[model samples]
Target: MPRAWWRQLLSRFDPTPIPDPLWRRALVSCPLARRLDDERQHALRGLSAAFLARKRFHPLAGAVLDERIRLLIAMQACLPALEQGVRCLRGWRELLVYPGEFKVRRSHHDEHSGVVSEAEDVLIGEAWERGPLILSLADVQLDLEQPWDGYNVVVHEMAHKFDMLDGPPDGVPPLPDGINRRDWIVAFQRAYDHLSNDVARGRETLIDPYAAESADEFFAVVSEMHWSQPGLMQRAEPSVAALLTAYYGPSPAPT
Candidate 1:
């Protein structure tokens, strides 16, 4: 009889299948989804429908969002959750979309100097713990246009969301049983250290240097590569790539 009980009961049921025309149209626009084998593609469609049913979307700063674009966003946002399942999508309920890059003001505190500074950041996508998922519509479309470019704003931000599930983003999400947590930590730490060293020395590296920003960002960045350019990721860091494949299942990126 309680709201929580009702919500739990409702979560057990799958949302209605996405309308045929909309699903086909969105699928045509997104090569990553198009490339998925039939079975997984079937799962993705239902998961995406669940996403559209559960999450609320808000268009801000002159951004335009129709049902078609919303379905497109939902499809990509739910891609990372296919292996993880629909439960992982539960914590967040709102999505804020911007026309392009949106700016957020931040305050940085110096650890030893006791000084605080304020700055602004231009971001294309971001995810918050138990909060809203934000994105730039233009960049989302760009990712659809350039599917194999090793970057996917939706996947990158969704990775952050998954990482935040257990706690703050730590480059590690809660693993299902039988997957050794220690192995994940060791493999990711070694790869993160190597990338950080390369970045510090100003060496060009295969994995994005932006990953060196932090372990959590490393996970998110590699997640983007996992979905968009797993081949390149395998070439750059085979161990990490193997772990990712094991965790996220095989990449659907084009050969």
Candidate 2:
């Protein structure tokens, strides 16, 4: 290859590395990521750097997004991509942060009734297909302090992003080579049905009842459990838990 070709390739692919101090500080703040083994942690640093380079951050509503906090968010966002590698982070380019909960005005249409209703939804995090990743700064900080709480706004929204990769969020993201798509769909559908039944009967449940909302929401909620409380998920749905572990790699949550 010509020397000019090498420079262009480098500019396109090689992102600026995170400085050692920034990496250490960000890692220290993110307990979920701090639990990764040294090799994976190093890999995460590179991924985080790439994420920061490729994604634009829009801090709105007085969201205090400093360099350290930005780096912290990048590290957590990239944690789920460690095993999948950087390819999984493609097709998106924005991260929007709010100081706290944000409200979105949404329109809902009923197919059978031909009725449309508009409502405002208060959200901590949300992801749209081929759009920006939105998050709550307060929730992100809370997850950092209570790392094992089985709730992470960033991870939950990121799961939706992953699910939307191949197409719409149908609870199944693009699978890796070893993971069978049929098996994944079967396991997740079974678990979603079980949870839906329990919620319908008004029974106590292990996984969040919000997961019963839809297939994609179930996937996102379980993904939060996978990173923060895999044991809880294992107890609720063994097969789904197993598949999630296989897809995202082992949970860093304390055993």
Candidate 3:
């Protein structure tokens, strides 16, 4: 089927609506919800419901569970997916939530000797391209009450999903038919180079320096900037902002 036809079909589907109690609980627990008004809150609830209905949630570590906790996780995870539209996250299935920070092991190999070395680190959430999403419930709870404007673990992980959409997480996704893929490459490259130079020169970067580490990180950091500091993102890299807007639509005016 053509992209236009898929979109048209999806348009006919109504966004799932969350129950009133759940929406109220989400507003109480998640500080991010404070930014939204009544109507927007309902809209968010609807989007979140659609996401929960589409994706599976797997709770690990803690056997104890409640509706509010799960809804909290769903709301945050769904925000980015909702912003991009329901079909954006269609490929993924389950969300495996751990009780706290979980250890992820990484192995290094000496290319010449072909010997392997291993290391581990704790993480909040990770998205696998063709696999399930891993999340830390404890970290998610911390995020619920915290007031950090742009530091959303859910959005960060979902950004990786966007990066992975085209193939590997290489800082870009498939553009609409008329948009030039070459132009996207140029724009992202220019922004990436600029960020790298700023880090090298010890200049203040609007986003974290970790963004300079890789194209994937660049995409994720830029995504955070899009929602957290849109004005700054627009000024520093208009093309990035344009790309985000093209995908997510214009953000609602600050209320």
lDDT of 2 at 72: 88
Q: What would the per-residue lDDT of candidate 2 be over residues 100-189, giving only the tens digit for each residue?
A: 999999999999999999999999999999999999999999999999989999989989999999999999999988999999999999
Poorly placed runs, candidate 3 (over 4 Å): 1-16, 31-43, 63-65, 177-179, 252-255
Comparing candidate 1 with candidate 2, which one achieves the higher lDDT? Answer: 2
CA lDDT of 192 in candidate 1? 99
Worst 10 residues of 3 by lDDT: 1-10
What is the per-residue lDDT of model 1 for residues 143-228, given as tens digits with 9 covering 90 to 100? 99998999999999999999999999999998867568999999999999999999999999999999999999999999999999
Greater TM-score among 1 and 3 belongs to 1
Candidate 1 vs candidate 3: the lDDT winner is 1
List where candidate 1 sits over 4 angstroms from the true fold. 1-11
Q: Order candidates by TM-score, high to low.
A: 1, 2, 3
Alpha-carbon shift of residue 41 in model 2 (angstroms): 0.3
TM-score of each: 0.94, 0.94, 0.81
Colliding pairs, model 2: none
User: RMSD for each model, in Å, please?
Assistant: 4.3, 4.1, 4.1
| Candidate 3 lDDT by residue in tens digits, 183-231 | 8889899999999999999999877788899988888877766655667
